[model samples]
Every structure is written in structure tokens, then in C-alpha cells.
Target: MKYPKIRELKEAIVSLLTPAYTSKFPAEPHVPFEKFRGKPSVDDENCVGCETCANVCPSHAITFTDDKEKGIRTIIRDYGKCIFCGQCEEHCITKKGVILSDKIYDMAVFDRSKSIEYQEKELLICQSCNAIITTREHLHFMHRKLGPKAFSSILNLNILNQKLRLAEGQDVSVEIKDGLKRKDMFNIICPNCLRVILVKYLSKGV
Candidate 1:
């Protein structure tokens, strides 16, 4: 290494004088450029726990679990597996549910669990078949989107009645114990069971 070529010497000098292309992240604060895709931030007020993010996530970073007994739906977001593809932000039904943040991008972590997040919403379980219905928040979101048309469905009407407490202390679950009867219409029955009730009983004017 006694003698260096003229081109090599010139290249060395140029590199030494030029500003670094890589930023000193830990040593200095760095602001990302405009339209930079970074961490995905959630707006809980607008998020209805619809599982739409989980469905569209290519990396499977988002997951959902429902506990029927507790009437709760848990949403899990593992940032360690996230590719920051912006699919969650793009397909969000509410449009304001999830969005990728441009400012906060530092996600370095030693433990994987530290990068995980959990959120819970009330589940709207079917009282008849015990089937897993959508979350209460999701139904409310649909009600807002559908407006007056939402009342066309008996399930939505029952949910609205429960929220408004039209009957006050009257128990809607009283007749659900016997079977899928006409009275089950007053309770939180699923669309399938509601269809059965209408076809079998209501059609004959029971």
C-alpha cells in the first residue's frame, strides 16, 4: 500500500469532503421527509374493531380474538411483524381508524413483546345461536353510515332500542331461554335466527 492511484486518491478526497448520506439517528434527531411512511397510529374513537385491518394485513401483523363469555373482542397489533405497507390505513372502513404516521419511525426494540399492542371492544354476541356477531362499535359505525336504512334490519332496531332504553327496565332476554321464538325478536338475535323467526313464526302471524 505504498502508492495509491490518482483516481483512488481523488475518490477518497471527495468522500471525505462530502456530507454523509446516512443520518446519525441515535446521536442526532432526524426529521423524516414529507409523505414518509412510518409507524401506524390508531384513532380509538373512530376505530370500530371491524377486523378489516387484520384481513387486509399482508404480513399478518394485526390479529383479532373474541371472548364470548366476557363479550369482548381483543385486537392485537404486532409492530415487529409489520412491513409498513400502509394496507391497514388504506382499507380502514371508518377511514379514520388507522393511519401511518410520518413523524414517529423509531421502532427499534430488544424484546418482541415490547413492540406489540392490545385493544379491546365490546362484542355483540348472538343470544340464540351464541354465534359471534360483530363488535358493538362496528354495529354503531354501520348505524351511522346507514342512517335511517339501518332500522330496516330488526337486529339494528333491537340494538337501537337497547341503547335508547325504550322499555326502561324490561328484560329482553326473558324469552330467549325457551327457544328461538317470536319473542326472541326483542333480544339480541343474529340475522340468521331472525330470518328463521320471520319465516317460521312471523310469516304465519304468530
Candidate 2:
């Protein structure tokens, strides 16, 4: 049989003497590289409980629960189901609310509950229907972004007129208008109630 090449024999000997490439995890820490997409984390101080993260999560790792009686909304994030895709960070309206860190990979736990995180915020109830509309923080943020015009659409004509007058430092009595109207303004009314109101207005042909 032909003898192995001298280079091959030398390489084999060197490999045997060299240290193993496998990491000694748990015994020694491992530092991930830059831009590594590891476990997701959130800044509760910056989070407004908008549910945007839950909506964008592809793996269903994020879920939201609303307590209508208590007017509370809870957002839960299960790390056990997270794929570390960073979609939550990408869609977070408040950039500091959610982010993917490079160093939080050691998320092993004996109990599934240990791997879950949650945050809760108070919800805003509709004034007329008493339905859970959204978080108070979300409403405030939208109002700040959209200005006083925010409530002009959903509020009835009387309410809208009063709101406008109050905002403009004027006083006026509420006068109800019995006609359909459309104006480009924002409102806190939930989609369902808005739909019903819209249908009623349209049927009146005004």
C-alpha cells in the first residue's frame, strides 16, 4: 500500500495536539458577535402597550389580554416560542420599547413560566358605550400626534362642537345635528362602534 504523504501525517499530528474547538458552555461564558440577534427585551418605561409588537410577531410568541372589567391590558412575551427574528423591534413605534440584544442567549429555564415576561397598562373605555377602546397611553399619544382634531370624527355633532369650542377657548351649548357628516379627523371610538355609527349615517343618505 502507498504511504500517506508527509504533509498529511504532519497535519494529523498537529490536529491531535491542538485544543478542541468546541466551547465549554455553562462552565465558561460565550460572548456573541456584534449585531447578533439573540433574545428579545423590552423597556417597560418606554412601552405604551400599543400591541404593535404582538401584531407583528410571526411566531405568536407575543400575546395581549384585555381585562374589560378592570380596564387593564396585559402584554405577554414567551421566550420559549420566540424565533429571534427581531420583527418586534422593527415594528415597535417607540424604538426604545423593544429591542433584540446580542448577549441574552442563555435563556434556559426549568419551568416554562420562567421564560415568559409581561407588562400591563390601564385601558381607556369609551365614554358613550363603555367599551374598552385602547390603552390610555395610546390615546394620549395619538391625540398628541393628531391634535384636537383627533376626536372630531367619532364624537357626535354636539360633542364635536363643544370640544372644538373648548379647544379654541370659546363656550357654546351642545346642539345635536340629525344628519350624516364626514370630516377628516381622528377619534378614540373603537372600530366596531365607528362602523355601526357609519352605517347609520350612510343609511340616512346625508
All models: lDDT?
0.89, 0.73
TM-score of each model, paired residue for residue: 0.94, 0.69
What is the per-residue lDDT of model 1 for residues 58-157, given as tens digits with 9 covering 90 to 100?
9999999999878899999999999999999999999999999998788877898999999999998888888877999999999999999999998899
Error of 1 at 156 (Å): 0.9
Per-residue error at 53 for model 2, in Å? 1.2
User: Which residues of candidate 1, in runs, are more than 4 Å off?
Assistant: 1-4, 172-175
Best by TM-score: 1
- Cα error of candidate 2 at position 128, Å: 3.5
* CA RMSD, predictions in order: 1.9, 6.9
Model 2: lDDT of residue 58: 98
lDDT of 2 by residue, 23-115 (tens): 787678766789999899888887889999999999999999999777799999999999999999999987878889998878877999999
Clashing pairs in 2: 150-186
